[model samples]
Target: MSRFTRTQKILMCLIGFFLALGLLFQGMRQASIGDIGYSVLSYLKYGLIDYPLTSIKNFASDFSNLWKVQEENDYLKEQLSMTENYQALYENAQREKRELQELLNMNESLSDFNIISATVIGRDVSYWNDQITLNVGSNDGIQEDMIVVNSQGVVGKVHKVQDSTCIVKLLTCEDKSNKVAVRINFQNEDTGEDAQSEETDSASRAESVEGILESYDADEGAYVVSLLDEQEVEEGMRVVTSGKGGVYPSGLFVGTVKKVESLENQLGQVIYVEPLSNFQYFDYVSVIEVN
Candidate 1:
């Protein structure tokens, strides 16, 4: 009871050591087996369980990344659309600015010719004689009989002038009262010189003189001559103001003749013409004032 014998103590010590060694060896063996099994699972289940799990995790991350990318793409597209709209507006403004500059240059070139610059403020489309109202008026030294010509050609005459505004009759009015003598510039194919209309010829009221009115410049002698003799004027013929009634200056540019048509008159021929200036598109003009 007080103390064990030396032999007994030695035996107990031996048993304890063996037991500890056995436990350590068993734990090592189990760990080795677990590591071997894990290695096998990685190799065998690569395409099935383990690999599929890894792929699913990667796919989830990719889906999140894709959502962010799509959002960014949509934002970029919206920005591009806005930029395009802005570009179109900028281009339109630039075109208008260029046109205004051209008009200013034309005014400078016509300094020798007395004229007034007028801005169109109103348009009358309903009346038989469509008229355009200008910002200028009698107060601005504008008066009736003043000829108005835009960048294209002759627009009309100042029919009425108020204190602050004036009315301009367009050139196309069909009142049978307004008439301007237009000379066609044709090269006599035989003479090689400019074709001349002899006013001395017998004045005969031919059949209806139907021709598209075109603009002519008196300076260059570009205008529509008569094609009534069934003789179509050659292309590149110039038309000019005849200075017959002094309606427009003799040398101002109207437009070039593109084609001609003819009708038989009882005494002479009637000619049809196509004007070169696109009158319908111009927005500004110059009013010719005779001193």
Candidate 2:
């Protein structure tokens, strides 16, 4: 046979080299394909598909929990609002209860007197001329000069009256027309005199130490009681109406003696009286109708 050409010989050697190389790597290529195929199939079944399903289930559970939390918050808000309303109502009830109790006590104390209850509606604008207006008026038998009193002591006298309202001049009034006849009450020792006596005699016997409720001392915040006679007056002594002028009834409490001093250009002592009623805060009063 003719000698093979140079190009043909080179092509045959290249093909033989590739054939040997392929045989040497044939086991490795098969093993790699088996492992890669198993890994790709597992990823498609579990990693690609099951991962999204698990995430969806978790999202649904979280959303349900969020709704439950929102509902609980709303319930708490409603309960808090109800609690606030109950607290306000309880406070109002307590205040009303105290006011009612005070009115009951006042009624029991002044049971013997002929009086009509009235509510204070207004107060004077001036501090010097202390005055208060009441709801009761002439229609309710409330007349001018009628004595007004509270549970503690005397409040004032009715100054003006209308069909449905009346104005009262308080004890703190600086006017001379507001003077009240009062007396210091003393414990009378039984002298074995006849107990049964005329009404006029009993009235005279009731007055022990007499004085005039004249003026109010603004500096001392007390009413000035000018004694009609020279008598021993001490601090803490009780003073009441004497009924000498027939305006206020006898035995109506006026005030207590806070201090005593010598009068200027007068014979008797000047007794300073602190009124029993709180003039600044009284709400209710009684208008007296003398029997």
Candidate 3:
């Protein structure tokens, strides 16, 4: 309408009027006038009324389905999130129960001592393997040099204490200053003595060797136990605290010999001991003392 001139628009209207007249006359000649009128009415009913109504109905149905689908999706997502949370909680509870069982066994083995159980609450990032912090502190009868142990063996002594927390110095500390008096319980028994042995432990009849666990090889994950003098330290020998120097108690498990080598200038034998304690993963420990 905008592009057409006023005269062109008038001409188009006239031509449409003539074409309608011709069609009307032709229909009137071929069919009854009433039938022609009825056909036009039928076209108007379908095109103007039924088509629009059906389209609106279909659109409403599709929109309702889309809304229901969105709601179901949201509901499923929420359920999945809740399930994940429950699964995590269940796993944590199982782990706690297992740790408690281990601690119970440890307590039975150390029934002679007054033991205070504590959770490992923190670790120094710079000295992760060397030290761990416990939830127990001086307020809970804790003090410096208190012996800390897990189900496996000696963890470390309490290095520092506060009102609510204490730091433990592990045997994996960088320096050799924290040496333990240890004895190697080896299977060097004579064949005749072994046949006569009644003890379940193979080292029961074997001769033992005393040494100092003064050095640690971090890369090898073993302790360098330097004997007083050159002696044949055999592999697979178990080491335990010797209870000398009034430091560690007798028979507390230390580690086993991974290998044995000679010291500098062959002055003594260097026994590499792999500890029983899993240094990477300990959650609970006990601070022990003589009753």
Per-prediction TM-score, please? 0.55, 0.61, 0.74
The alpha-carbon deviation from the true structure for residue 225 of candidate 3, after best TM-score superposition, in angstroms, is: 1.4
Per-residue alpha-carbon lDDT of candidate 3 for residues 54-162, written as tens digits (9 for 90 to 100):
9999999999999999999999999999999999999988877887788789888888888999999998788987899999998999988888888678877999999
Candidate number with greatest TM-score:
3
> Model 1: runs farther than 4 Å from truth?
1-112, 123-129, 188-236
Deviating ranges (above 4 Å) for candidate 2: 1-103, 125-129, 186-208, 264-267
Query: Candidates 1 and 2: which is better by lDDT?
Result: 2
- Worst-scoring 10-residue span by lDDT in model 1: 201-210
The residue-by-residue lDDT of candidate 1 on 202-284, one tens digit each, is: 13323222232333323333333343233345445555455555666654444555544444554433333344354555567
> Candidate 2, residues 135-181: lDDT per residue as tens digits?
99989988888888875667788989999999988888878777889
Top-scoring candidate (lDDT): 3
Could you report the Cα RMSD, in angstroms, for every candidate shown? 9.8, 9.8, 13.1
Which has the better TM-score: candidate 1, or candidate 3?
A: 3
